[model samples]
Target: MITNLERFKREMEPARQLYTREIQDFSKKYDALGEMSMEEFPDIDTQDYIFSFEKVNGASEEELDEIYIEISNHMEEFSRTHGIEKFCQNARIWL
Candidate 1:
């Protein structure tokens, strides 16, 4: 029989791994965007953008814009205070 602590650890391990992976992926994307390399940026795959928007089907454009603005403001604050590295590090906490 698995001990309670062992069971809990096993359950939490996957969540932690997933969170770390997401954090790393977001950091990479953020860095890629910050480079402002036109060749690389706006580089988010169109299909991914489409899919993301589709996931939020029915969201008004204004509502989406507001959300984007809010996120941008938060990112700006993080960038100013902690820089990208720490901002991305803290993103996991929010995620």
Candidate 2:
């Protein structure tokens, strides 16, 4: 039987592919985002989470902007298809 984690992994492939190379490399470093789960994300809107993600920290602001746009759209779709709680619990935005 496919576990939820496996299913989530499979489901995320296309969204992952849509990510910019910068984001793809970032996500890959997180082990397919196994570490992205939020214990208690305080934001009611995902936009807040996206906007506040990773400091510029010498990274390109242009790159971070692109990452935010991609994540905002993709994450909303994922949450709609899945459930709010499930989706939120599974991923976080950080770099």
Candidate 3:
């Protein structure tokens, strides 16, 4: 089993072009409403959005696992610090 820290570290690496491609593919899946909605934007997912990381950039299962770990850590830190900007900068999973 992979530890949380290990997974987070992996996700923190630079986002490859493949990742962007996946995002684009995701965008195509939705109709005009989904594509035009404010939720479709942003590198991160928000409550209003239905962002998916399943194949973000065509990442493998291992990569997605790492991304999840990184997201979890970011949430934990942000919750404790209450610093959105700093947390966002620190939590950038796309490097």
Candidate 4:
């Protein structure tokens, strides 16, 4: 039987694709900045960039909250490790 988790995965596919494309585009633009080379940037693993929705549709609301909290934590860690402030500061005018 098709499960809710499976359904959620299917429903979220398009959004995932859009996010991937947008992130890649943003990364390219960020790389274009002459201040830092790609080597200087954090080596972001493909898995780290992916949002894990495993069993999410079947998860309880509390579990879902935990999942989002974990995601936010990871994002904050990535931002800190990769000097996101510098990027945001420089990109602020364009934004």
Candidate 5:
């Protein structure tokens, strides 16, 4: 059976390609993953996604801040382990 999220997405954006990331291993639980609206017209192969306050849909400020903190931590860790290297492909964002 189709879930509400799946059904809403189908009706709202049938032709759009979506990429999802599971909320995992951030500094804290930060489990704010749900119903994020597409914030930009994607350049599908771009190295990173940019979420903006201007484009925010139903998400709260805390949820956005959680994302920022997790990304900041990831970047700090990445620079420590692998400085300025694009270790993974953009397609892994889909995984």
Candidate 6:
């Protein structure tokens, strides 16, 4: 029988694929901008960040929280290094 974890993973697969594609597109769009500082991209909206994942049917609250935290941390670092606009622009998961 399929486990809960397995089912959850299956449900999240589509969102993950979408996130990857969005990020890649954002990277390409900004590739010509060159290294930009945080101040350069002042329109970044962190309220609805990309890494926020919808809860899977069988996933526990704890599991979803962990996933969000992991993604948030990674995205935070990425935003700091790559600018918040780039981060927000590529954030299609929550969009």
> Residue-wise lDDT of candidate 6 within 1-95, one digit each (tens)?
86664554455445445445544444333222222111121122222223323333465666545644554455556555644434344343331
Per-model TM-score on C-alpha atoms: 0.33, 0.36, 0.31, 0.34, 0.31, 0.36
lDDT of 5: 0.38
Deviation from native of the Cα of residue 72 in model 6, angstroms: 0.6
Give per-model CA RMSD: 14.8, 9.9, 15.6, 18.4, 12.2, 18.1
Model 3 vs. true fold: TM: 0.31
Q: lDDT, candidate 3, residue 61?
A: 62
Overlapping backbone residue pairs in candidate 6 total 0
Across 42-75, the per-residue lDDT of candidate 2 in tens digits comes to 3323221231343433556666566566765665
Q: Please give the clash total of every predicted structure, in order.
A: 0, 0, 2, 0, 0, 0
Could you give me the TM-score of model 1 versus the true structure?
0.33
Report the C-alpha displacement of residue 24, candidate 2, in angstroms.
11
As a TM-score, model 5 comes out at 0.31
Whichever of 4 and 6 has more TM-score, that candidate is: 6
C-alpha local distance difference test of each model? 0.36, 0.45, 0.38, 0.37, 0.38, 0.42
Error of 3 at 41 (Å): 22
Candidate 5 Cα outliers beyond 4 Å, as residue runs: 1-57, 85-95
lDDT agreement of model 4 with the native: 0.37
Q: Candidate 6: lDDT of 40? A: 20
lDDT against true structure, model 1: 0.36
lDDT of 1 by residue, 13-64 (tens): 4443444444334434331122111110122221100101121235566665
lDDT of 5 by residue, 1-95 (tens): 75654554344342223222321233234344433333433342332333222323455777666676665556445534543333222212211
